[model samples]
Target: MARVHAPRLIPDPCSSAAPRRPLGNDDAAAALGPHPGWARLPLVVLATMATVIASQSVISGAFSAARQAERLGYLPHMTVRHTGQHEEGQIYIPSVNWALFIGVLVLLVVFRSSERLAIAYGLGVTGTFLLTTTLFLVYAHIKLRWPLWRLIALGTVLYVVEGLFFAANTVKLFHGGWLPLAIAGIMGASMLTWRKGRRIVMAYQSDVEGPLTDFIRRARNGHLNEVPGTAVYLHPNTVPTPLALSENARFNRVIHEKVFIVRTVPANVPHVAPQDTVTVDRTGADSDHITQLTLHYGFLDDPDVPAGPRIARDHGVDIDPDTARYFVSELTLLDAGRYRGMRKPFTLLFMAMSHNAAVPADYYRLPRERTVMIGAQLEL
Candidate 1:
């Protein structure tokens, strides 16, 4: 008798259509149940309060004094450092922790005007709260298929909770809470700028890289081009612009005609289970000569998961391996003071430690030597 191992069943990768099913109450109910009256309503409200207030208090009252004192004209000492969580035992700054207690205590006794900052503070905080709640409502209505009344009840509570966070944060602001508000404003602006920057950078990237077809042509004509029955490319979730797309086409000199960009989504809480996969929507004109596939997976999914070529093989789509190559772009980050924070070395180190760990490129069976890494310099 011969020992045998059963081959695993991989999903069909190149299919444009997803598995569809009729809307049944059971599935809808199960989905709706997650956002029950308590979870979405009361429980979320409680968690929100605990999160916002506690965060503000810790940031301001706790370490706030040490940071402010070191900056100001008193006994100046204690340099601010981003230690990068070297100490396994300690979670945060201890000296600052105790100092905040003292500072808040002293503020309570001396500063009678801690209320004025509340108004300025409340605007940003409250607005975010409202926006987040509204987004939740929209998500619930659109995705979960919750009843309108139930959605209202859930959203109303969330809205009210966000309202309270704003209200309370506002009160703190007017009472000499400018720092927190200022910090929030700076953070909000920074986030917006970062998002915009990603767009600009992506646009520039696609442009510099040129279109896949052009790159493929160039590769075919030059060094980058090689024997290729297929090639899979991985991309970040940050969307690409048309300019970048055109550029990518031009730079590549030619395109794989067959490519895949798999992205990993971040999860709020860690849980391992039936990991969902998303197909990346491809742009540019479609030709049987080339096929671009996008896959979306989350952290909960094992990073070493196989995709595309594997799927094609499992699904019986024709693809030749010895000729196929996997292409991955490496993003190198440098800490530039242009963003107004931390040294570049530290940021780069952090990034290095956290490279693509979830999945190795060769997991799909293209082999390491066959893979190509294009170094991409990220905009600081």
Candidate 2:
């Protein structure tokens, strides 16, 4: 069967009518029948459907990767909409979707023919295979505790094969392979810059906010004027006092009667157990009325701010969800001329990314009406 189909599926180089370009799957499909002309339309339709399915998978994978990167602090927070009610992984990221759409348009305009596009696709696939194999080997050694000799042997064999393919693809770098490499480089640099910038900003904010325990001590010492109503401040961690809480106290000269410092922690697992969702600590005595709520969410879990306090209620924390006010800090980046933390270019990129990132209220599904944004400036 293979011998009989070879002539039709693959163009013969010796044949005078052989096409200049290599035969693709579409061509092979069309050539399968006795009459190629009659099978062309059906092959086109099938190819179109296959392309749609492939594109859908790529888009979905991009969304999932973007979300995971954001959660892992490699990328800035973006608006994530959960598309599936039961499946947490089924998410739609508008930013990623639009970016991919624009990229596709640009690539289509730049590379008009599939022949040229194939060069970039070859490099992309081989590069992906090489990196994935490398990562898997590392994971096997560290996480799976594979023997060093076995790992080295397997890795050497895999790397040699993939390296040869990658090297072959690199020969076409100037032709079309440079496109994917350029895109990967840009994305990698952006993610690294964002991660480093965030660390610098976080360190600065930590210094400004001070220790949570010290702030609690101050409140216990009657330093803060008590006001009526419940206030929930969303923080990244329980170590430092939330910037919103500090700013509110500094500007208004008062703190809420019942203050809830909520921190949503991302768990390692896909979905945290329902019973282990929330952990509430009253901070000090019952008279203090200052509670530290830690909401544990898996990477796939939705970090809903408004629902956090309600979840705490089930965990024996007295929180009034109806009348609660949410407080979040809005950070404005200022480039310090003599700043040594990050490079000037990266600082600018980080600032722009930060400006475009989704606000906490919208990202966490907090009620806009009840949410208060306390502006804080950070010099980088």
Candidate 1 residue lDDT tens string, 134-175: 887888888898899998798778877787776676555555
Alpha-carbon lDDT, every model: 0.50, 0.88
Error of 2 at 198 (Å): 0.6
Write candidate 2's Cα lDDT for 1-380 as tens digits.
Answer: 45554444776788988767788888996788556578789999999999999999999899989999999999999998888888867888989999998999999999999999999999999999998998998899889999999998998999999999999999999999999889999899999999998888888889899998888788888888998999999888788999999888878879899999988888889988878888888787888888888889899888877777887787777888889999997779887774547778888898989988987888999988999999688777
**What's each prediction's clash count?**
51, 0
Q: The CA-based lDDT of model 2 is what?
A: 0.88
Per-candidate TM equals 0.40, 0.88
Overlapping backbone residue pairs in candidate 2 total: 0
Best by lDDT: 2
Worst 10 residues of 1 by lDDT: 70-79
Worst 10 residues of 2 by lDDT: 1-10
